[model samples]
Structures are given as structure tokens and as C-alpha cells.
Target: MLKNRFNIAASLLAIILSVGFIGAPIGPNNGDPTGGRPTNGRPTDDGPNPKQTIALGDRREIFADRFLIREMKGARLVMHPPRDEGPVMHFDQPWESNAPAYITILKDGDTYRAYYRGGHQRANGKKEDNTCYAESRDGIHWEKPNLGLIEANGSKNNNIILEESPLTHNFTPFLDNNPSAPQNQRFKAIGGTNKTGLLPFASANGKDWKKMQEKAVINEGLLDSQNVAFWSESEQMYVCYFRTWTGGNDRGYRSVSRATSPDFLHWSKPVEMTFGDRPYEHIYTQQTSPYFRAPHIYVAIGSRFVPHRQIATLDQLNELKVDPGQHKGLSEPFLMTSRGGNVYDRTFMEAFIRPAMGLNHWSARTNYPSLNIVPVGDGEMSLYVNQDYAQPTGHLRRYSMRLDGFSSINAPYEGGAVKTKTLTFTGKALEINYSTSAIGEVRIALQDENGKDLPGFSLLDSEQLVGNEVARTVTWNGKTDLSAWAGKPVQLHIYLKDADLYSIRFK
Candidate 1:
């Protein structure tokens, strides 16, 4: 009888091996090693299975992408618009009277520096664009300091920094934070047109500037708009995002291209950025840069241009005193995020900064945001936009948002839950930047890779988190420390009731 049983088992094993089911488990409980259902009370569906565990070592993950999300019910990622704080600085200077395009703001130490292209029709009947400078003790109020570096309008008493043609048309600069960067090249800038390629400039103090090289370092694209370059801390190299046409030289839709360089001089071949499955649209200027709070994520507040989609009629354009040749198109700001690659995640297709309640904002090339979003006040960050473009009323306006408030996972009053993908984190506590209604709250549960709630970290043990804070620690049964589960594969099940979870980090 024993020999007969052994023969039957051997035959079954052979059949299983032939069918390639040797160690494969089958059924609804396959996700769990113990042949039990997930503790989250939901059967595993044929959705995206958890791949390799993400090693998020105390990094703050924002809700700008669906990277770490597994499943969500009654909740979604929502983009938040910045609050318009009105015009902060006017382009009323003689050199900046016509229009001020390609604005870039950098907060260096205690002073905020503003750089932009200022141009006005010269007496010779030619439009001469110059790179101008301004400084502000507070981001709210700006003053043009007469740097007297470059002579403009027959005077060196202007705030003109560079008067070189083509280069000053869209001069964009950033403070180099790379440790290996030379002291003289502390502030690096890129500017030029397609005719001249893209030129590189450097400065020891941002006030004094010189060409890093006599010739253009990058020469492969249209390079008409603001060609922005900065030392990427996450990539440990210099990255540049510049303007390019999809069909080639000013033929197809205006898009963006990216290139990298080890030394800012030698650049790799440019690669056009792809917006997955998104319909082709004119991306006039992609103000792509690393977010200050989270350097790993590149935030782009680009201008979406619709040629001939004129919102302001001729009469309205005349009423707003828009320039004669600039009234054909309409442009508005849009939000896009990326994770250090050629792909941009357009999670929110809506306008980031909608046209305000005025015809001046509806004019052509209006509502173009500046390059960087800088922090202004406590838990507040500000983004500057060029409103009333190609008009005498053109100025840089400030818009504010809560820190890390670009997008959030919002849940209604009926309540909802979100589950994160399997991840291993380092840290003793989990902190979140969130806001909730008076009667609303948020709760969190730590679960194993199989979605089984870990002991002492279940939803029932989670204390209700209520109120608004930029960073609030989550606790379970009045305990905040989670060091015991550090470096272990786990998932986060978050329950929310009319709350907005902006960002979360384990630290």
C-alpha cells in the first residue's frame, strides 16, 4: 500500500512539473503565503501586481504622481490652484516698457533676485531686448537696482545686466549648488536663439557675469524660448530643458527637449520629452525645474498655447490695449511633473492658473508663469506669472500656495481609503502634510506586504488625526514611533473623511 501511494505521488509531481506549476500557488488566497484572504477584506484582483518593493528611505513623497499608489476608493489626486496675490512688480522701466518675457526668480540668502528679458522699441525702429535685474528684501515688493553693468538706452544707470542681442532675449539663470562646481561659476545661465544656439554664462556674484564659453554649448533645437539649465542634485549632473518643435524647425507643435552634461560644456544628444498618450498641444515654455522641497521631482508650470484660439475678441484686445501683432493666440499655465526622465506626468490636464476675471489676462502670451517656485512665508510658496503680456500693463504677479500643496489625495465627507504599493522605508515616524474639515479626520494603518494589518498599527488602533498642519506625525494608540517595522516591506492604508493629504514622509 505504501509503495502504491509513493508511485501515485511521484506521478502527480511529474505532471505538476510538466505543467510548470512546481512552486506556484493557485486560488484567491495566492497573495498570502498562509492561504488566507488579505486582512484588508478585499480579494486580490487581476490588477497591477506589486513588483519590486520601493526603497523610500525617509523621502517625502508628494501626490503629484501615481507612482506609489496601489488602489484608491472614493479618493483621487486633485491639483490645487495658486491664490493670485495681484501684481507685485510692473515692467514700466524704459527698457522694459514693451514687454518682459522669460522671468526667473531665485532666493539667494536673504535677498530675492529677479532676472528677465526687458525690451522696448529703440529709436532705430528695432526691438532691443536686454537682460534686466531686480532685487527684493521681501518677495512681495521688488526694486530694480541700477547695476550699471550694461549700457541700455545710452545710459549705464539702468538695471540692465546683459545687452548682447539674442542671448538677452531669454536669459535664464540658476544658482549652481553642485559641490564640484567652481566658485567663479557659482551662478550659471543659458540663453540664445536658434540662430545663435544656446550660450552659457557664469557669475561669481550674480551681479557680475561673463561667458563660460565663446561658442554655444548646445546647438540642436529651436532654442527660442527660455532654455533653462541647472545642476540636478538628484542626477548629479547638469540638465537642460529647451524649446523644440515636434516636426522640426518651427514646423509642428512647440514642445520641449532635454539634454544632460557632466560639465555644463559638453552635452549629450537632445531627447524630446514625451507626454504619454496626451494629445499634441503647443507647450510654449516649459518652466521645468526641481521642486525645492522635493528635488527628486521636477515640477513644470508651462504655458499651454492655443494658436488662433483667441478668447479676447479684437474689440476686447483693443480695449485691453494689447500689442498689434500679439493678439492672435491665447496662452495659460499648466502643471506637469516628472521623475528625472524624459517623460512628464500630466495627471491634471486642467489649467493650473486659470485666466483671471479680466480681459487683460485673456490676451495673447498672457499668464505665463516664471521658471521657479520660491518660498515666501511660513509654510507658503509663491509662483510668479507674467500677466497682460505684450501690453503696457504687463507685470509679474505673485501667486501663493501652501507648501507641498500642488496636488493632494482628496476624500469627500462620505469617507474613503487609499492603499499604497509595497515599500520599505527608513524612519522612526510617519509625518503628513494634510488638512481636514472641522468634523473630518484621517487615520492610517500599517499593513504587511499581503495587506494584513500589523500588530499595534491597525486602523482601530490609529488615533484620529484632525486639523490642519504642514507636518503632523501620525500615531496609533498614542504611539508615534515605528522603528520596529523599519526596513520591512509594508503598505499604508489611509482612511480619510473630507481631508486633503498633500504629502507624506517616514522620518
Candidate 2:
């Protein structure tokens, strides 16, 4: 049987070669430009079935308009703030006091760990930076435990995890999620100057670091910012996003570049990320990390800097006692989401978390978020930011958002509707993460792949849902059963009024 199959395959290949049918697309989106197509790729009237079978997984689908969406009402991005007006961790230590910045936090088991750059100190006679450490229990309160790992300022009683090298400058480490990664290389990091190139570092416990190799893993343009590299579960490869230049009418812009590596050692040529129709600006520290719950959507709370956008007066600046450079340039954390492919959706060209009302927070480079966002409380995740940069009051502050709450398909008291493209799912019931006003309500309707209303799951049958919940199941006229519809192609028509739908997934 195997021999006969091989013989048939070989005969077909020979026939195709003889007819010169190489590189021909055999199916939809198979590089077949000649296929009957539409802008939205909806099946033409009297054409093929308009259904798309989704893979078997409860993927957190956001309201990014990645697929076909229609009649979405007054939906927009919402900003989140810290629980209180305070910094989670302060730069009070002698070694970290000079200019503590480039913060990265990760949750390991029970304890949450943090790392930041310790700038040069005149009294300590240190000229370069050091990687300092901090830990937290609730992410709201942070402490720099004296690990005694690296000696600094004439003593080892410090939170310095990495020091005495250039790796300390912007050293960012990520928990290597690669199943095949070595036990000794559980945590991997990349940090170096553009001139010297990016060097790879690995650690067994994130405390003890070792160089991956003598050579640099990635060498590219203008990597002075906090360059981030991580293992993508969605893409199943190591992706590195760093700073570079985009030479166009948009010259001298502090842009972001992306590259992928299979082994985290060798990397492809980096390409600059494009924000469709968005104006050019200085995107400093593109803290691009995978959304823990929704790894497919790479969320970036980047520090968008304005080179000369001064918001501080001389007396305000003098009160903060910050460096002169703090008088110029301003920065705030902005929300950017990307579904891989080197494309970012800047749907909300606004600050996700703005600087607070203070003289210290109004300085240049302030409000820069940490390298990672970690899930903290139930249905809440935290994003830490470096505030009052170059000032004596410099500190790492925390901001929290509801899970999958970055953006939403919101509607006013006057109702609006959103219809999804055809998709096949393999789950019994659908659940949503949403919030609504006391009077607001949301209703969901199920339709066939061709937009025909399902018999018992149509709009008239959907029960009016109201309330705020991280997970709420959709019911239709007291009917919660959807087992029969599992593994079938369908569409979701959601009518939202005075509510925001963050995400939806079949369970």
C-alpha cells in the first residue's frame, strides 16, 4: 500500500511538472490571486459556503476588528489607573538612587519578582548601570530584598541580581516557555548596545546569569531602548522587538523593529513595525509582551515619547529636583496590540495610563511602564511604570486593568450591534467578559454561516443580559444548552447597549 501511494504521488508530481503547474495555489488564501475574492473575503452570492472553521481552542478573541465585524457602536479603549496614588517600589537605595529605570516584573509561583536598571552613582564610583532586584506579594507593595548576590556600594546587602557588565544596562529576562529548553536555561534575556550588538543571556533561577555564547544573538540598528525578546506560544518561536529607525518622511522617529529566532541564538533580519495610518512619534521602550490569557494578541504598553513636548515649568521642575534633560521631552504609556506578523493595531492612539497630577510625574520620560505586565488579583492584571524619571522621587508605580479589559466593543445607552464572521467552534456554551451600566443590557444571537438565524438561538430568543462579570455565559430565553451546535460553523451577532464587551470564548 505504501509503495502504491508513493507511486501515485510521484506520478502526480511528474504530471504537474510536465504541465508546469508548480507554485499553483490549490486552495483559498494559498497565494491564489486568481481565486474569486472580496475585500472582506465573504463568500459571494451563490458562491461557496461562507463559514470558516476555527481550531479547537478557547482563544480569547478581542474587539480589534481583525475579522469581519459590522455595526459596532460607540466602542473605544478605556484607560486604567493604579489602585491608589502611590509607587509600588521606590528608588531609595544608594546604588539605585542615581537613576533607576527599565523595570521588568515577572510572577514566579507565589512571589512576584522585579528587575530594574541601577544607574551610575558618584559616591559609589560606579559609571555604568547594574540590574537591581525587587519582590512583591500582591504587586501593589514591592520590596527590594537584600539578596547579597552582587556586591554594590562596598557591600553585598543589595538587590543587585546582575552587575559589573554591560548586560546590566537594560537587562530584561523572560521565563523561557519553550518545552525543549534546557533546564539550566529556563530564563533567557537579551540586552546590549546597538554598536556592540545584542547578547543573549540565560539563567537557571534568574538570580545566576550566564552568557548563552560569546557572539551576539542579534545585531541591528539603534538599540538604545529597552529591547525585549520572548518565546511566543502563539507563533511558537522566539520573537524580539527592539528599537530602530524608519527612514522616510518619518525620519529620526524612535521606532520599533521585530525579529524572530528559532533557538534564541541566531535571528532573522529585523523589520520595523508599522502602525497603520497612525502618525509617527517616538515609541520608546516597546514593552511588547504576550497577553497571559490571550497570548495571540501581543499587548504593548509602550512609552510614547515626545522629543520636545515640555509640560513642566522651571519652578515645577526645580521642585522635583530632576535632571535638566527632564525639562525637555515627555512620555506616557500608550496601548498597542498586535496579532503577530509585524503589524500593530494602534486603534486607540491615546494614553492607556497617563502621568498623574504632580510636578514629579510631569517630567520627561516619566510614566514609562515596566517590561512585563503580570496577572495579580482575580480578573485584574497589573502594569508597573517608572515615574519621575531622573528625579529624586523616582519610583516604580503600578497600574491595574481588568483581564481582557484593554479595549472593548462598547455601546451607548442607545443600542448598537456587532456581527462576527463565520467561524466553527468546538464548545458547548459561549462566555463573555463584559461590563455594563445598571440599566445597560447585552443580547447575543446565533446565526448560521450564511447569516440565517438559528431556530432557537435567534435575536428574539436571546435573553437580555446585564451586569459586570469577567465570565458570563450567554443564554437564550432560559436556554443555556448549546451542545448540539458544537463543532458547527456559526456567527455571533451581539447587540450591546451601555455595555463594553472585552472578550468572548466558547467553553
Best candidate according to TM-score: 1
lDDT of 1: 0.84
lDDT of 2 by residue, 1-507 (tens): 779656744643353344322333233322122222332233321112434445535677766433334223233334444453356777887778446767789988778988889955545564767898888888878787878887666788888887745667788889998999999999898878766688999999888888888798788877767889889988999999998877556357888999999999989998888775567888888899988887877888899988877877888787778887558888888877777867776656667776778767777888888887788889988888888788887878777778877767776775556566677676778899988899887778898877677998876577778899999999986888888887777778776668888888888
How good is model 2 by TM-score?
0.86
lDDT of each: 0.84, 0.74
Residues 243-291, candidate 1: write the lDDT tens digits.
8878534568899999999999999999999876566789999999989
User: Using lDDT as the measure, which candidate wins?
Assistant: 1
Candidate 2 positional error at 61, Å: 1.2
**What residue pairs are clashing in model 1?**
none
How many steric overlaps does candidate 1 have? 0
Q: Which stretches of candidate 1 lie over 4 Å from their true place?
A: 1-49, 121-126, 247-251
